[model samples]
Target chain A: MDQITLYTWIGFSVFLVLMLVVGYLSSKKMKSIRDFATGGGTLGPYVLGFSFAATYLSAATFLGYPGWSYEWGLSNLWLFLAIIAGGPIGVLMVAKKVRKLNNGQKSLSLPDWLGDFYKSDILRVGTGLILLFNIFYIAAQFVAGAKIFEYLLGMSYTSGLLLIALIVVIYVYAGGALADIYTDAVQAFIMAIAGIGIFISGIVIFWKGGISDTFAGISHELAAQNENLVAVFNPESLHFYSIGAVIGAIVIQWAFASAPHLFNKVLGLKNEQDLGKMIATYVVVAALSVLVLFGGLYSRAALGDTASAADLALMDYIIWAFPAIVVALFGVVILAAAMSTTDGIFVSISTVFANDIFLKFLVKRNIVKVSDEKAEKIAFQISRLTVPFIGLLALLIVIRPPEYMGDVMWIGISGIAAGTMGPILQAVYAKRKAPARAAELSMFVGLGSYLFLYFTGIIPSTMSAGAVSVFIGIATINIASWILRSASSSEMGAAEEGGS
Target chain B: INEMLSIWLYGFIIALIIIGFSLWKWYF
Candidate 1:
């Protein structure tokens, strides 16, 4: 084959081997579910930082974002800038207290942490079910990865999906949380390098133009068609969603640091010593996010008008705009971004199922008779084995993707945000003793209100249904807890940190 | 590169200010 193709395959093979080695090496420490789930609290700041950023970006950020930039023009760049809000949210809001509470708790999963925080299994299960919607989103990420492989490497989508599933399942099952974090760090570096490489190449390619030039061209083209391209909130333009979408985006992004999976990195932190460095890592990664986002705008300006297919502008930039070698390298980065995330999702889900469902449900009810040692072994075994099960489900769902899958994910995330954000934020931030029932009520009411308003179209056109759910969720928590915690101090326990 | 870096720097500066204020509230 061609030299570029040959080199790319070699590079891809090397990356795959490196991932396997990281997982295998980290597996040496995998004596139990702690290593499998939370790195036994050993991850350093840089690794956790990179891993968190990489996991957050996903294949969707790389693939779908440029298409948005292509269609919408410069105003879309604001959304990417909005992503940096995660840094402060991670440090001030989530990480410090999460790390503080986690001290001596030996908590391994989000469910365990939240359950213990509120001392409610009902809350645990409810939140766990809500988080399972993440599986659908993760499944979508896998589909996007398979599509990327199909686009770049000329692989059949079916073969790519199967191969991707097998690889993620293998490494993640073996490495557990340690494997996911380590491999994610490596994947983050690959993404950052590829992001910059693609950005610079986009600028140099065919001397097409800068951000200002691109917007000017868009204005020129639009003017000829009796339209404008760069307004902040253009409802009439097919090129842009309403300005309200940006508000919705900012809310979603600002809350993004609270995604329980992303919070997995916080749980993985070793101690308070690494906190500042970890936060700094997030800042650096956030800076890089701005750069990569700029690249999206660049690609739109450079190649928007000529491409027959608007959505594939990114792929075209790599293929026609850059050299074959750049294409091959970027191809590896794209697939790496996709696969590494699958590995993290796999470990997270497996941890939830084995620790949250199997152990919490079965052992607590005395459905299984086993020693603590035997129980830990069973959970570890379950965590590893559940990978194939999730893989199978995702594969099946992908094959016959629901018509409303995108909307389903949107509603599910809003429901989850409504249900969990209020409770979790209250648990961490508020000192007042909200009753356990407060968490349960808030989750259900939040989700219920979001779904009710959205399905009934009662939500105002100007307002976000998700934000409304959030407001309702917070109000539910405050009102319910105020009522419950007042005369029920015995049940509430009134303890801020550990179990009273 | 300068522009991208500046935006991030300013954004992070704002982040740090908020973080600083929050920490003060938590401790003081």
Candidate 2:
């Protein structure tokens, strides 16, 4: 084998072994469903914080988004800005509230929280079902890992996909949430190092005189290729062609904090007091990670026409800029980025299936009867079984591989964000008990509108469709709630008048 | 030097401020 491949194999083997060891150790502590789902809410700020940030900065952010910046130039910075601001905003708005609601409870999943909050089984089950859309998002992560493996290790896409799936499933199944959090924290550190390395490398490559000069040089080079490339809102681009589109991108991304895998990190915190530190850590790490976007502009200016496909732009730059050993190590970092998010997502899907659907809904309804202890054991077993099931489902979707990894992931993201954003915001912040009917309507309208717009090509940009649907969802909830409240009051008044 | 690049810089700076303020508010 070549030196790069040999180093990569060694790095990957070591990383995988460390992860499996953590999983084995964590499994020993997994006595209850709570332990499996939320690490029994004993995780400190650093672990929860790093795991949250790592899950947020997925392969899509590290790999796919840079490719976008390479293709569209500075316009992609709008999305980055949204991400930098949105994450903290989402946490500020909801993290404390979620922790308060879940305090002293047996680790509530997002769906379970919603169900209990609204007192509606339908809402919980609906939310759980909507979260399943993450299967596609997980598939996108597989595609990204496979792409890197194909480029660096000369592995076939299918081989890489299966390999990643097997490794992720083994760890997640063994240790559940504890294993996921521990490994994700480690992965987050690796990602932070890689992000800093890539960002510094880009600056060093284009260091004409200083930062401004570097950007000027990149702008000049890109402008020479195509004037539109240097423009803030590339008229030719689908994602950020206008101010409206940029706003749409921001709106949708802001709601991305509501994603189950990302937001549920709050439930893992040791206490509500740790929330501030956790959010602070997450913001710092996420900000650092986003600097990697600069690699896109660097690659575009430096490689020019010889740059590889857009999705591979950053990878190409890494290979060209670094020595073989460094490149091999970066291969592991990229895998960390991919698997970190995928593993969190796997735990989430399994938890929802076992905790929300099977135990809460079915057993509570007596459709599946057992003693309480037996039910908990059954839920734990079912959660473990779900890891491979989801891995297999996601693997099937990615076998063909989509044209753009970002788009494939966005398909699921837009749907989930659209469906849950309104309800979650209302549930967390509303003064009164948020009407269940209103949440139900919001979810249906939000998800339905997004699917209609996405599949029918009505909006042309998934971000725009997602944003519009989120607005519709929020509107539907407010309007439906007001109408219901008024009607109920009127009915009460009439009955009182008749009784008098 | 490009207008778009300048806008991006400003936006990034503003984003940093927003994030900093958020952290301050949450902590204090």
Candidate 3:
């Protein structure tokens, strides 16, 4: 519509071409399936660290977080703190053990890791089902990215979704983990720059209104919500449910990076020491990202009170206060966030289906037993092709994108959080090892509960279903483990006495 | 008295150096 808009498209087109070229070049060297899936475990810290961070922070953070904060006022700061709490704890606790276990096992996906840990095909298949849930999750990311493009660039949402899906498929399928890591490094840098720019611009607006006046405005606006926005904690309020929602957010954010795609990055680290470094670096960087969450609150306070505030909060301010160039640049930043997340999800889903599901179920089914080398190679090849197929699947699913793309993305995140986090935490850290049977039971219970809540409409609309499901799932696992362990201990004592 | 004290201090210093070096190499 205008010169700046034309220039923005031009820059995006150039960026797209550059990514394609990189993808093509990276595809040229495909000596083994290992190379495709794990970058032959040669990726340096720069790629490993940033790729991990960027993949976790999707368009949901870039667009949806700010919008939600805008609607809720500064009180949503609790959610930001929740993210900070969960990220470091996860790194210090879970990551090292995962790295040690991954040694010598060529795990192309998270389910592959589960298979290695449990030494059971059934467990691996169950993990694959969990990954399949990510297909809808990844679809949500693509839809959100496209909806943003449609809203800002005047393109049809379908066209935008298709374009993003195609790019992700080609780049990931062609270059595998190599392209994803490199592009991730670039995307991470772009996000950091974009985040800083938005913060500074938003700060300038507040500065113009003067600090005191800004607070006065925010307080007045928050008054409509009963002036409880700045009051940090109110135990007996509807906001109480929302505040409690922070715990679920914390668990999900911490575990999201440890999902199949990103967790595989742990194995790709050069050594045990590097794994430690990755954890520390990732935790620190991730902690800093909480600032963006605060920036969202600041923007909300600056914007006037309105009911439809969530969707319009961030963009509304940018569109009005900034020049066309700055607005366009911010759009690109959101685009990068969406693409980084969707691409990782696409790669992860493909890896799970190809490596764990198809290779185990279809390709290697006839063999009574398979060699490690053959298993690794087949899993790698299947994983390599999975990227594009997943992209195609996402393209189809996202054809009719949801109107509330942000909520859709969170729903997907909740599915992973509830289904996987409960089982993973138990298997990794609980003093008693959950039997494979118990873990499997937890997965089903968690997934079933989430679906039930969604369909039955029993839970409050604003609360995350994953929060309730994970709590229930963990309870189920602990109870089952206690009963099974007690029975096994008694049987073992009887057997020992009989043998003596 | 001086020799024993110095020996104890030297061992502590060397231990600290080794631990510091190991951590630096591991993290950075």
Candidate 4:
């Protein structure tokens, strides 16, 4: 429509080309399935660290969250704290153990890690089924990113979604984990700069020539409407201050430690020492990302509650206040967030299906009839082929997403956390192994109860289904483990010491 | 300005303390 909008599109097109170039460069020199899946376990701390951060903050953080934060004010900081702490804190607690286990198992994927740890092909298949929900997960990121483009170009939502999905599939399909990790590192840098730019832009809008300006605290319009808009905690809601909110934060954030796509970066580290450095780098970068979180506060302060969709709160403000190029670059930041997340999810899902489900579970007793090297070559090809196929599957599922998402999104997330976190923690920390059946039952009961209590409204929506599901899963697992105690401790040392 | 800043500052302090305690307990 305007010259600036045209310039914005030109910048985005250049950015997309740059990303494709990175994908091409990373795709070279892949000798094995290991390279495709885990970057051959040779990625350094910086690459893996930024990759973790980029994938951890998805399109939701970029788009949906700020608008939610805009309405709620400082209460939104609780969610912000969750985002900054989730991956860093999770890694600080568990990454060393993850790397050590990687050494013990040489796991190509999280499902592989779980299967080997529990020694159950059935559990691996179950984990794979749970992760298949990445179709929605990938689409969730796509939807968030597309919403920004939808606003920017004034196009149909479907067109933006299709454009993003195609870009994610192409790069990930071509370069695998190598491309994902490297591009994620670059995306993290871009996001940090974009976040700072947004914060400064918001701050400058309120600037005045004299000693003081009426726009001192939130927008003049918002503060005029309700002075509580500037209050630290609007005692009525007590959002960030509530006990349930804090606990909910912990439960959802713990999923960072449990998610396959997020932590699979750890499985790609060059060495244990690098893993420690990765934690520090990841934490610092992600924690500092709070700058972007302030964009919502700025948006609310700059342009108070509007009739626009809550997700568009910040973007709408940016569109009105900033030049077209700044808005367009911000769009790149959103795309980076979505693409970083989608690429990782793509790699995780495709590799899980190819490596864990097809090769390990379906190849007749985890053994293929060929030399180890030849089997690995076939596995590599299968994983590469599965990338596009997995992308297509995700594309198809996302084509007709549920109109009423209901509790399905949160339920699915909590189920994944409840299902995997309990079993994985025990495998790494428990002195004695729980029966595989107990592990399997924990997943089913966890996922099932989350949906059941969730759908039945047994647990109030105020309380997280994830936290409830996790406790239920733990309870069921503890009882099951105690009752079905095995006499032998043969699998006791799987992820713990003495496994080899 | 101070009130809004104080609230967010408190949230950040509390979150950092949690991380501090965790790092000490796990790594120290």
DockQ for every model, please: 0.18, 0.63, 0.04, 0.40
* Residue A88 lDDT, candidate 2, scale 0-100: 69
The candidate, 2 or 3, that scores higher on lDDT is: 2
Tell me the TM-score of candidate 4's A chain: 0.82
Off by more than 4 A, model 3: A29-47, A170-178, A208-243, A257-261, A267-277, A294-299, A302-309, A367-403, A461-463, A489-500, B1-28
Segments in model 1 whose C-alpha atoms lie over 4 Å from true places: A1-7, A21-44, A174-180, A205-229, A234-244, A259-274, A305-311, A367-381, A400-415, A451-465, A485-500, B1-28
Q: Which lDDT tens digits does candidate 2 get at residues A276-356?
A: 788778877887888888788778888986664688888888877988888788788777667767876787788898889
> Which pairs of residues collide in model 3?
none
Clashes of each: 1, 0, 0, 1
Tens-digit per-residue lDDT, A34-72, candidate 3: 355446367776567766666656666666666656655
Tell me the tens digit of each residue's lDDT in model 1 across A1-500.
26656767777899878766655665575446434534526667787777767655666566655655555554455555556664355445666666665565666566777787788988878877776666666566666666655566667778877777676666565553334566567766766776676666654543436755643453454334333335455453232255555555556555556644356567655555466566667656655654565454555555556643334567766676667777777767776766766666677777787888778967876888888889999998987777888888777767743322233334545666767877877877787657888889998998888778777877532126776777788889989977765556667677233222
lDDT of 4 by residue, A329-359 (tens): 7777777667667776776677776678767
How much is the lDDT of residue A453 in candidate 1?
76
Candidate 1 has what TM-score? 0.79
Question: Fnat of each prediction?
Answer: 0.13, 0.63, 0.05, 0.37
Winner by TM-score: 2
Best candidate, lDDT: 2
Tens digit per residue, CA lDDT, model 4, B1-28: 4455554567667767776666556544
Ranking by TM-score: 2, 4, 1, 3
Q: What is the C-alpha lDDT of each candidate?
A: 0.63, 0.78, 0.62, 0.65
TM-score of every model versus the real structure: 0.79, 0.90, 0.79, 0.82
Model 4 bad stretches (over 4 Å) = A25-44, A176-178, A207-216, A219-242, A258-274, A366-412, A455-463, A486-500, B1-7, B17-28
